[model samples]
Target: MLWKVFMHHSSMIFLGLCSGSGVFYSLACLKTGSCYFIEWELISINSCCVSMTLILDWMSLMFLGFVSFISSMVLYYSGEYMSGDENMNRFMYLVLGFVMSMWFLIISPNLISILLGWDGLGLVSYALVIYYQNEKSSAAGMLTALSNRIGDVAILIGISMMFIYGGWNFLFYVGDMKDSINKEILTGLVVLAAMTKSAQIPFSAWLPAAMAAPTPVSALVHSSTLVTAGVYLLIRFSPALESTISQSILLLLSGLTMFMAGLGANFEYDLKKIIALSTLSQLGVMVSILALGFSDLAFFHLLSHALFKALLFMCAGTIIHSVKEFQDIRAMGSLIYQMPLVGIFMNLANLALCGAPFLAGFYSKDMILEVAFMSSINFISFMLYFLATGLTVCYTLRLIYYSLSGDFNLGSLFNVGGEAKIMVNPMFGLGLGAIFGGAFLSWIIFPQPYMICMSMGFKTLALSVSILGGLTGYLLNMGSVNYSLNSLYFHKMTVFSGSMWFMPFLSTFGVSKLFLQSGMKYQGIGDMGWSEYYGGQGIYYMISSWSSKLQILQDSSLKVYMLSFLLWLMVLFFLVL
Candidate 1:
């Protein structure tokens, strides 16, 4: 009966679950006294605890507060966002599942629990991605699942290594096992996993592919759930990452990813894909900052990015809905007049994303650059930093320009107006947060001394450089002559080369085709080949082949089945031993 009711009214059930669970979480946080003992639970001989260190600490509190607040707002927004859609209930269930999984992830005390929540979130996200049940959505879902599976395998291997070399008890605190684990090997594995999860370099393709998901899913994933998981892992295990070569690799990969994604966003014509790429770039920046061992700064940036990115994605959804499901920015012109509320919120969010002073992104992003400068005096780091900053400016400006800046071109279009109250309400809430949340949280998160360390003159210089880059991009869009050729080439070259079209033919075609052919060749060598050879022709051939195989198998089944089961058990026992 419960299952039937839930299936029938999944949306209401999910919303109720979210609200109830959130209340429980808040109560647990408030009642729990210490970082390690909060929400203590015992399962058989194993004990588990929720880490409240971040919750009690100022920095973690700010992020937690923002996560909770934004989650609530998005839920409210979803009430209307998916209104009247056939799968609204299913979408709500997935959203609730994602939020709960993220909550668990943030408070996870041990690596095991973290992995649980991590994979749980991935599972929910896969469902959300394919919610529309279209060919594109299905493909995107498969890509996301495959990419996350690769990352999961790496994480599992790393965990196994840690348990083997380090003590089992050390799983609760990665910092404790840092000295025991082989730094080089463990770091390499962890970095591989993190890079895959964060969509760095080659793994970055999955993020853009995920744009086929609903707008709300995109907003949630980009803002605070999926992409942020990698950074969250790094921040949680900062002590271990900092001591290993992983930190340096993270810096290199993140810097490259930021620059590449930023460039890609600049050239992207799809509105959602642009935001998706922008999320990748922004996540890269966060990862880079965390790689520098500035946990507070990274968390700060995470908070800010979540607010503005969510607002931006929601606004994009609103615009698409307003124009009757059109997402091509090239097709969209000045929508500001049609959807004034969306335009205002989107513009504010864009300003914050561009790192305008006093906004959320500005303070956090500036702090990241400051930490990078302080940590590295190398010319390469400086060059990478400069390139990433410039790309950030160009892409952000491009997003603003192509969508909101042009003349009102209703190009063969019809009705346009403000979004549903559900969508606009969330946008309004996120815009307010983007505008002032960073400033409010800065004091608590940064404190006095840390703020002083981050407020150095060189940090100011970096901010100026980033701002100048943004201004230059903005001016050039407006047909200014003062743009530097060096900057132009840097922006264009990076953007052009980062595209899927620029992928090596060997990578896209030769290797993929080779793999497919190898699989077919292997099937031909096996008894499975008989079915493949006959199945495509007609039902008669398929039935004949199947009947022959069934008869042959049945003739030997008893002995074969017994032997196979014994062999499998022996192998399993051997492995356990």
Candidate 2:
């Protein structure tokens, strides 16, 4: 047990050191505008080079820093959160493996090489999701794995298509091949893969479902390692997508994703799932901006969001851990009075999520929205952007009301207090990041501030919607014990909106219902009915009956032998005469 604790602490320290080194290197690279590529040639054929390449640039290094830092905190927190489990060592190893997979992904610019990390993420996440070994966790793991498998398939096809270009290193030739049919197909595949990874639109269900994982895993997965991978990949491929049809499609889907996630989050009651949905919404924000030709902005938001979201999950973990694993918000209230530290940090993360003032989310999210407003986008994209932003605030405040402000609903006998030092320490580390990580990232990523020239209404639009959303969220939830249910009046519309526009149904049961039904039919008719009658069982029964009759005849031979011989001799004599 002591060694296990030591293991987590040691891993945390190591990752923290690596995080510092990566951040420093990233800043140096940014300052000097320098990038290093280390490549080892595997083979060359017809002027196409195949090799393992590592890209050391500001973007990759910065991401590495954020991922490592968050991972370190998560590991430290896990030491206490999962300390009682028998497989603590295995859990620690799995988390390390997950981080290593992200590391491979961050450094590699080669399309072929990137799959090592891409597929690694899917496999390792599946392992982590099912770590609890419950039926729910198993189902969630399958859904997560299968959903990501679509992206894996897309990446594989993309690699095959890139083969035609005589090299798998897309960085070397993507710009040169711009607007060509092959380039479009390759970029389209890449976009499709990113959409699935980032949980955009059609692929959004898995993100919430993946909350069956341990909270520390949730912190890492939702914040950095898994969900952001798609966004990161697109950032790398942004050059190919600029002004193309792929960009337009990605913009539409990512916008819808942002709106859908925010809307769903407002109705969701699960603590971790709400955070997971928020992660999905933020992913939408990042990708939508990427679709708008601001890869740097997307990357910047990705890093900043990672910091606060990790902190948010850790705080949620502390709360859930304190309250004996009750995830339902209806079962929780007035936690702020009991768990003051957790409530403070959780609300801090939530406010940052809402883009309040100068917090981490304010710098990137506010900039992304402002840039979206200034961009030459269609009216639909424009409304989706602002509406989604409003919904973000709506859900965040609703969360605070239910989990932090109301009367404690769990009765007086429950054990709920934030006394875990291991957990609190990580939240503090991330709290600092949540407060200033955005400004720090913005300064490093964009040395020149963006110039905004908009009308008064457009300028105040973000704040206006945010205030309205917060009011709606808070006032709407304020009700007596027997308050009338408004959602029942508009049941169908409420259900549609709350259920992510039936995407979970479409992605899960809608897609699998036919095949599942077919399998059931096959099992009934072939295995239980016709096949049993005519196949192996039927033949066995027939053979057994024949053998039984033959045995009986052999056993009765002594009595009948004399009579049979007499009859045979008479027949032979008659024939001779």
lDDT at residue 177 of model 1 (Cα atoms):
59
- For residues 10-42, what per-residue lDDT tens digits would candidate 2 score against the true structure? 999999999999999988998899999999999
Please give each candidate's TM-score: 0.79, 0.89
Model 2 lDDT, full chain set = 0.90
Each candidate's root-mean-square deviation in Å? 10.8, 5.6
Rate residue 436 of model 2 by lDDT.
88
Candidate 1 regions off by >4 Å?
1-33, 36-64, 165-172, 178-181, 451-460, 475-511, 522-577
Residues 269-370, candidate 1: write the lDDT tens digits: 799988888888888888887877787688778888899989988888878877768898767777777788888888888878878888988888876776
Q: Of the candidates shown, which would achieve the greatest TM-score relative to the real structure?
A: 2
